[model samples]
Target: MRVTRSLTIKQMAMVSTVTLIIVSLFILLQLFHFVQQRRLDYAQQMESVALTIRQPLSEAVLKADIPLVERLLATLKLSGVIARADIVLPDNIHALHNEFILEKPVPALVSHLFELPVSIRIPLYSPERAMRGPLALLVLQADSARIYQFIRVTVATMLIAYLLLALMLTVAISWCINRLVIRPVRHLALALKTLAPEDLIAHQLPLLVGHRDDELGQLIMAYNHNQQTLGSIYNEMYCKASGFALPSLPNEALFLALIEQHSKSVENAAPLAVIVLRVETLQETHTLVTDDQRNILLITLVNRIRDCIDASCVLAQINHSDFALLITRDSHIFRTMRLARKMTRKLTQPVTLGQFQLHPETSMGISLHEKETPHAKELLNRASSAMMSAHYHGKNQINVFRTGNGDG
Candidate 1:
């Protein structure tokens, strides 16, 4: 069985949030336990101090020894556990060693919730009787300020720790997700959206997506494979239908597509020119040379044209003996004419093929784009017509198509 490995941003958030909550709850539980334990310990300490002074306190009260009783109360008050201390007589009389009194009555709810000061009343009995009736009352108020301060500090510390932990977790989780998951996914999505047939043939994918080994990588590989397969099939169909083998340069379909796309862009305001070059002596050269020799000659001719034109110019073998050059708006009429003449001179030069010197006659025709009629097919047709007219003039001739020119 395969276990699916999938993690999303939402899932990450939920997991992190749950983890933080659990940790916070655990800290709170520990804090509560600590507070309760401290409270019990403090209460025990207060009781122990009261017990230690019980005998003296009893003797002083029984003999009506005010000085002795006052000293005992003062000693009891000195203990950190006791916030206040006093002695009370049976006749409803009271003597406070420190004159300690409750400054303000605390609400029951507040006291219960926060565990405020607690008052303990211990009965004093006669020393001889051991269990006789109480001679005096010893009241001790537990010092709650220290415990309350501890509780407040502990709660604040825990809250701050929880927040810091949560922040750190969030940052770490988000960074991991973005690096390992979200970023890759987003990159893949954009790559898919912008994936082109040419890019697939070149085996190009987004940087991160191409390098990954996960599901996104698999998806991109699959897409690239499909695109390559489709491109092969399309090329096969194209060659069969056109009755010509595919050439190294862009096909007529791609050429026309580029022209149409460029025509739509308003930013291309310069004049555009389409130049067609027809090899008039191609058949003669083919009969005189082997297939290999013919290929070399064609390669040499294409290379010369490429050297003469700017890299941005689009060149394509449009037909068996014809080539098309697409000069963008960046070029002017003068530049286009110069390139056409240069191509004519290059192609008409004598080439040595297997001990035989052969010179191929070529005709060049150029047509400038007209704003009123801006179509690729129309421009190509006009250039073709001009090339045919050039063929009528002489070998290695050039012609330019103009509006209302019967020659075109």
Candidate 2:
């Protein structure tokens, strides 16, 4: 058996994938925002520390206060903004916190998303020294090792939360769809399968319980109405019609019902092939062979013809020696013509009827369906006319009728 995919699985995958993409975009945006905010806060703190120490360091340097310069540099490092500082005023001095600890570092790709400033430089001057440009430059490099460690801890925790949220959302969405939609549709299908086609009035589909006044509930009501209509219409046609009662779609008696149904279709599938196939030899067998033998042969031939079609089509015994095949699901009539040839081959096979051994002769007529003749009755008449024309031409003949042509 071929495995058909369930609606739930499809819905789950589609909904989950879309949601994950959205969540990922949001997380990416949030990461950029977090980094931007951290950069702003770091800039403010570093500037404040640099300003407070700039004057004292300048004064210390002007008075040649070596001890004061050391104290100022130490304070700048301890203030916790700059990772490493460098003072350049002819004698370049550097101070770095070698004890800075980072618990976890963010990946290079994550850190590169935003172009955050790595370091800043501040110029130091003293008016008291009567120096116009006699000053030092204070360079501060950011403590990214610590900043990224903070980001990593936050992101790791949020990633787990996001994963859990996505899983829960997928489950919730799939469950809701199955309960609200798929389950109801499945129930409707099961109900339809149990319905008896011949006696549709007695097998009314029960309305969906929770979906009253909704679209699905309305659909169920319409289905029950259709069943009643079909049953009553079939009963009426069987009682009143004078001609041969068409067998069901599965049997010829229901052929009129299918015609009635298809007549109402605007497209009714495609430009169909309405065919009238006459087994001239099968009809001749009625006179030469026993009724039982003829019936057996007819049944066998019908089954073979049924095998040629895979999709839904109407096949019915329209006459004692004739059958009608309506290919309503085809894209073109070429496949129907191929099927006709195959059926012709089946008919030509020799049959042993007691003492008589004979090969059946067949005459087939095909009419192309068009928007001008949407009714199955009209299409059939055209094909039947064509079949009669084929019969006039002699045995084993085929004739095709164009939609608008008067002379087929």
Could you list the CA RMSD of all candidates, in the order they appear?
A: 12.8, 21.9
Task: Give the top-scoring candidate (lDDT).
Answer: 1
- lDDT, candidates in the order shown: 0.76, 0.73
Candidate 1 global lDDT: 0.76
How would you encode candidate 2's per-residue C-alpha lDDT over 1-408 as one tens digit per residue? 232987778889898998799778777778768878888888788888888888777787677677777677777767675776666674565432232233244577656765533577787777575777757777766677667765777688768888789889989988998999989987877766766765556567777789888999888888878878888787667644533432223334456567657656736567767788998877776787776877767776777778776666778777778888877676276877787888888777887767778788888998877777556677778888888898889887888877557535
Clashing pairs for predicted structure model 2, backbone only: 246-252, 246-253, 247-251, 247-252, 247-253, 247-254, 248-251, 248-252, 248-253, 248-254
Model 1: per-residue lDDT, tens digit, 65-141? 88887787777756667778777777658765454434445556546875777667788889898655788788777
What TM-score should be assigned to candidate 2? Answer: 0.50
Backbone clash count, each prediction separately = 0, 10
Provide the lDDT at 204 for model 1: 51
Give the winner by TM-score: 2
lDDT measured at residue 369 in model 1 versus the true structure, 0 to 100:
80
